[model samples]
Target chain A: MQMDERKRKILRAIVQDYIATAEPVGSRTIARKFDLGVSPATIRNEMADLEELGFIEQPYTSAGRIPSDAGYRYFVDCLMGAQTLSDEDKEIIERESTKKICEIQEVVSQTSRLLSELTSLTSLVLGPQKGKSAFGKMHFLPYQPGQVIMVIVKENGVVENHIVDVGDNLTAEDLQKVADVFNQKMKGYSLSQVKRSMLHEIYSELSRQRHLIDNALEMLDAILDGSEEDEPIYLGGTLNMLNQPEFRDLDKVKSLFKVFEENEPLKKLLLPRQEGLNVTIGGENTLKEFRDCSVISATYKVNGKTIGAVGVLGPTRMDYGKVIAIVDFMTKSLTEVLARGKPRGYK
Target chain B: MQMDERKRKILRAIVQDYIATAEPVGSRTIARKFDLGVSPATIRNEMADLEELGFIEQPYTSAGRIPSDAGYRYFVDCLMGAQTLSDEDKEIIERESTKKICEIQEVVSQTSRLLSELTSLTSLVLGPQKGKSAFGKMHFLPYQPGQVIMVIVKENGVVENHIVDVGDNLTAEDLQKVADVFNQKMKGYSLSQVKRSMLHEIYSELSRQRHLIDNALEMLDAILDGSEEDEPIYLGGTLNMLNQPEFRDLDKVKSLFKVFEENEPLKKLLLPRQEGLNVTIGGENTLKEFRDCSVISATYKVNGKTIGAVGVLGPTRMDYGKVIAIVDFMTKSLTEVLARGKPRGYK
Candidate 1:
């Protein structure tokens, strides 16, 4: 299983050639095209060893070999060279990152579209985790006669609103008083940091307004204590999968489409587990639907906190060296753009 | 050519048979399947007349004939029978309509998914029009040292927020005073109804706070006067296109995918024009990409005001009776569910 220099060189050649041409690589083709400084016979012996070790597989007895999942894993891990992004791609990233974005959703969506277009693969950009954002402000605005729109603004500038029925008895002033008390207690704490004890303490302190604002308080408590909602998945270039030769079979296309429709499984696959870039090749994926695909994802940070991730999905023979570079570069660009926070033309 | 009862019956049989089975309908097959009293030779003569009239076309020289776009239109307009919803589909629609939907977005998205699952064709649901909703209330909440979140809530319960920078010099009290002025002036006026003269009057009245709130006012003016922003398209079952026999060719799939990816053309095709259900078949579509397809769309209303639409897209040989019935029924169900507006468990 140890990959010496010669074996590594040959394996890299096969994977790269297959990725570029979507054609299996024979020892003769490799020796002719890759300039390995070795004869076709010697390369043939090495190819047989690679196949024996499970790095490559032949689709037909007579056909040449293509990379197995393990082969791609090894190629991505040990042999892939540093990839410099094309100037055209770099320009697109710069232009999108520098655009006057009014909302974080726009940034995430633009990034997803840019990733898909550049790499010609399906892209998924997970929106920032609202649960991780520190409380900035809260407002209770009177809506129809019996309803109120409760707005929550997070430190990272994400906003969420829910309607609560308070009946016609309570005036706008009454709701304002409750908002003041809630804001005083919850400000600067992330949703996860606002524990049950803290909520109980706040309830006891607001005993006088308790009955009138009970429903609002309960709703607030539920939101703070609830399991994290799924981050909105900004899917882009879903049809790009059609361009890949691996998805020519309609069943594969259907399975992939079903995964996109369900969304939870794909989100689970892309959820950032740790800092930095990661690649899951073929069988490395736990979901059966994605077992035949490769995913390259990188967590993006804002003020040193891992807030979201952008990922690319394609066949296992994906252009790893290029897609990985684009994804890695995108995360950095997004981080810088978000951290700047001062959109051009904003007074 | 006038369509006599016999011609109509024969054309209906041909269209229905072709729809049920993807194969072209030979005169002999039609004679065997249908209880037509006429002989095969008589049916063949009538089919030839239908072809001469451009209602049907033979795919190959000797193969049976299939309905042309004109034939489908004729079937839909004159020959198709009223279709009743299957009990299973009715149950699904009723269940979705009655479910606890906290937001209009949830209802629209759920309906799109339901449409796709029921018919096994791609579905598109256009969300409610924000421009049509009357103004309800507006709030300006203080955020970071130099920023404010401006929230506009329409009468229909849609909420939109934008961040405006007002600098640290303006206090929360200043924002409240500005909001009071805006609420008093803009309440009950739809965005379309707020005239330029009315804005001029407000600007003159807020002359004292003009410099401090100039950017916020300009943003409001821009939003009020700008063309409508694209309503979010809730697309579902895009991969369902592969299930159609006509889309087996990769080039056709790619063209359909490209249309979905671009969105503007598709949205234009689906935008509700009139009050009732409408169907565009095959060559009738203005877009070349959709010329080989059919789209059935119906606008759903709330309180008798048309606001949104739901549509089904499939090949030219789509089950017109079934899809038209579903789309028409869905619009009615959506209209009723939306008008109720009172979600259960809202306390």
Candidate 2:
């Protein structure tokens, strides 16, 4: 793992050339192309030493050498140059993110599409963590007989509707009264803030109007129970996988497709982390299907609190340095976008 | 391509064995495992003839023979027997599809997941074509000074929301009256059904109510213009490609991932077709990236009209018979579910 300047230059050259051509690099090719001012024989000697150090591999006798996974790891850690996003890329991100921030769902969904298109990698953006969000406003509306519509509007302007079956028909005026009372009582209070004691007090006060209060409580339970539907994980750009040669094998391709389809494993993979970007390399992944791949993920925050994760997946040989940088940049960009309120022209 | 019964049996044996073991099949092993009642010498003679027929190949002189692409193709076409889904798989599909039919997005998303899980192959479900749908109901709700929330409800009960910025301000009552009038006039009419003459007549009649009439016209224009946000092609289960051995090569993996992320090409790939299922094999797909993959896609229907496509993606070596059956069954299942007004409560 320890290397001097000459070895570092040779390894960097090998990785860069291999990444570009996707072919093994020869000492001659590196000497000719890089103009390192070294003879092929000397370069060969150093490459042999580097191979012994496990940074490179000779795929076949005459085909020259390619960077091994260890070499990629080293380059990503110390040798690979920082990749600055082009002005065009920055403009794209700004233009795309600057659009109306209607809801957290819209933000995450659009972010997923924009990042995937920008990075040309399969991108995943986890929905806002509901547990992290404080309750905002809850409204109840009557729809049809025995059906009540409960709407929860988050501070972030996400409005989710749930239909609860109350099993008893109620007059429209009575339902309107219930909506008013429920809104007055629950406004600006987090679900957790409504403690059992508080609920007991409210229950006793409304006991005289038992039927209306019971239906209101039932509606409250339905809204709280349906919170899971509010948090939807967004994935975009899966067809991009068809263009990669790594997925050419039928079995490996099928297994990966299955993994993406069966999102439970991936949901676990993108769970919110405490700090720093999480990089799970091939063998390090718990899922057997993803063992040959690497996931570069970072949790994006809203108001300095971690709310969701953004991730990109590719071969383990993915340009970790670049992907990490891209993911980091996207998360930052998304945070800034979400912080800024909806654009002036938008509703 | 023509062969005797003995030759067909030998080729089928080789393909089946290779599929299971992912290893070359030797004459002795095939003869022993298959109980062909022929000696190794006789089996070897048949193997030599099979090799000459381009049905199999020898990786090395001493190694066993592996089925060539043509051999696998033949097995898929004429030799492979029907494979049944397990009872668990059937129950899973039935349960999941039933639960998912409540929402259009969930139906497409879950169908992809179920197909990928059952076949262990990547699946793609194109979003239902909004253009093909007749308008069921449209509602316009005033949001702020100059913006309105246009909610379009389709015949299938799919709801799409778009925020349109109009240059005029209207009161809440005016917005509600506009919504009611528009709904009364446009119900059961497709976007194409409203002609310019019809708009002119309505405009003339509502000349006194300029703001409401103008906003309604703008809403109609926005809907007909097909804003990008109004319709998005759904792609699911792409992570499955990472598990394919063909993508083991880093560059190949990157390129494939790139294709999936850039879905414009995929949208073109799922172009509108007439009714029935369409299977595009390797070399048949126009996209260069998909030359090695096969797509089994079928258009779904509502009210006897094609609305969207659902498909599975896998290597050209995929089990065609099984995929075809699954796609066919799922398409029928989806149509039936959508046809039912609401899912029946499970006991």
Candidate 3:
């Protein structure tokens, strides 16, 4: 629990060596690899103290030591800094974030791919769920002689259509008159605002004007009553787990993928923090199955309001310093892109 | 290639054994597991002949014979039949196919998940691109003071919205008048039908009435001009690749994932035939990366028109009989769901 300067240096050495070569770091190897200016015996004594203190462990396969979950936590929480990405990486993140994307879904999907490709680790992005959007347009178009289709668009570019039955006698011009009223009232308002106004005004009016295309008004009311569903969660490089030595066992891979199948409960892992990146080392995650993994996540924003999260999932031996910087840079870049919403030529 | 009954039986026995155990089948083991009415020495002689004919192989690790790509092709082409799914599996497939889902994307995504979970292999579903949907409705809604959003809905429940600048002097009533014209003429028609009528009529009218709200007309023209982009390719159970005994090599996993990335080119592997299921074993695939793997695909339809394909990807040692049956049943089930489009109460 109480770490001196010499102990910290030796622990860092063990962690770095183990990460580089998926093998245990012995005292001689650490002493030789790191210019700590100490003999293998002295390093071995410090390693013994560190292992006794629960920072590292000696694997049964070799005399070398590897970082335990506690060791990784100390490294991530106490020693890690804001990693500086290379200029090439920065350029890649910036370029990918600013590239021409077709739909908002495409943006989320492309970002997931880029994050995984950059890190060679599994990446996940959640949110911009199209639930709270500014109300855009509403219209009633005739379907069959007795059926009319109501179409609504949210400012976030989500569109929904509902089929409702209207009287055969109700003409298109008559339906247009009712649509005009909805437009007059809903301009520049979000779906919530429209809901509030409709509850306040449309009910009594529909009751009184039952014959004057009121059925179409009721249909418009119903269409405006709801927003779109949750935006898709994009996951990339799921098979990257196989490349890790930790996942060579088939059972471990199954449990990890079982967590992926249950995406709903995993969303609880994303907390509502306002700023800064969050790191949860092995054994610190909410799900028990993720004890062998590490997650570095950050809440991303659009127009300065945090709306979603982007995170990386990898073995505890993940390149924390590098991956954190990449995720951090991407969070900012994605925020900027999402804040702009749609680009000029995007469909 | 012509095959006698004995050779066909021997190939089938090898394929079934290899698929089950993921190990080479020695003549002794095959004789013990199956009553082939032959002694171990006779079975061994047949296996040698089969290996010489390229139907089976001897891995460096074992003296047993494993099915080659040709063996699998022969089994599927001549010996295999539709494997009967168990009652539990039938219940699962039925339950998953009939479950309530909100978005059409969810349908594709859930189906992918179900297929993968059931087969313990990677699953892919290509498209219902929304290009050939029955036209639903069109609506234009005001956004800012100077812009309006045009929304279109397809009967298949795909929604698209595009924003265009409108004259500041244009009233909501004027936009409604334009919508009414669309409702009158475009009802009960697909996008192709609208294109035909618009080409015959709207061009002359727009030329004659340029000043009478031509901007709104132009926006409608543009909205109707484009068809939907390719629907996203849904893939699931990628991590399942790691569970395969054949995928123990990381390099093999990487090459398989590389094929997953180049999805556009993979579309060429799908055939143009309108009915039934297809199997491409090992080198039968278009991409060289998939030469060690096999694909079992089936063309699915919405309203009797084949619009897309669904397939499973696994090693050549995959269970062709079981996977083919599942793919076939899923294709028909997916067709039913897509034709129904949306269930009651789905947003």
Which model scores highest in lDDT?
1
Residue pairs in collision within model 3:
A137-B141
| Model 1 CA deviation exceeding 4 Å by range | A1-4, A133-137, A154-157, A184-227, A342-347, B100-102, B132-137, B155-157, B184-212, B221-227, B342-347
List, residue by residue over A184-210, the lDDT tens digit for candidate 1. 988888656778887787777766656
What C-alpha lDDT values do all the predictions have? 0.81, 0.69, 0.73
Return the lDDT, model 1, position A195. 81
User: Lowest summed-lDDT stretch of 10 residues in model 2 chain B?
Assistant: B338-347
Q: lDDT ranking from best to worst?
A: 1, 3, 2
Please report how far candidate 1 places residue B194 from its true position, in Å.
6.7
Comparing 1 and 2 by TM-score, which wins? Answer: 1
Tens-place lDDT per residue, model 3, A1-347, is 57998898888888888888989999899878899999999998898899899999987845789999999888877776558898998998887877765456777778888899899999988756555555566677655677666666655555566666566677787677666666666765754455755745654544443554455445444444442433446788887877899987767766777777666645655453446688878877767778888888888876566677888889899999999999999988887887675532112
How is the predicted docking of candidate 2 categorized under the CAPRI scheme? incorrect
Name the better of 2 and 3 by TM-score: 3
Q: What is the Cα-based lDDT of residue A38 in candidate 3?
A: 93
TM-score of only chain B in every candidate structure: 0.90, 0.78, 0.82
lDDT of 2 by residue, A191-295 (tens): 556778767766665554466566555555544444544455677777666556566675666567667755677786676344657777666678888776777
Residue-level lDDT tens digits of model 1 in B43-102:
999999999999999998989999999999999998887878888888889988888677
Candidate 1, residue B120: Cα displacement in angstroms equals: 2.2
Residue B334's lDDT within candidate 3 is: 83
Q: Give the higher-DockQ candidate: 1 or 2.
A: 1
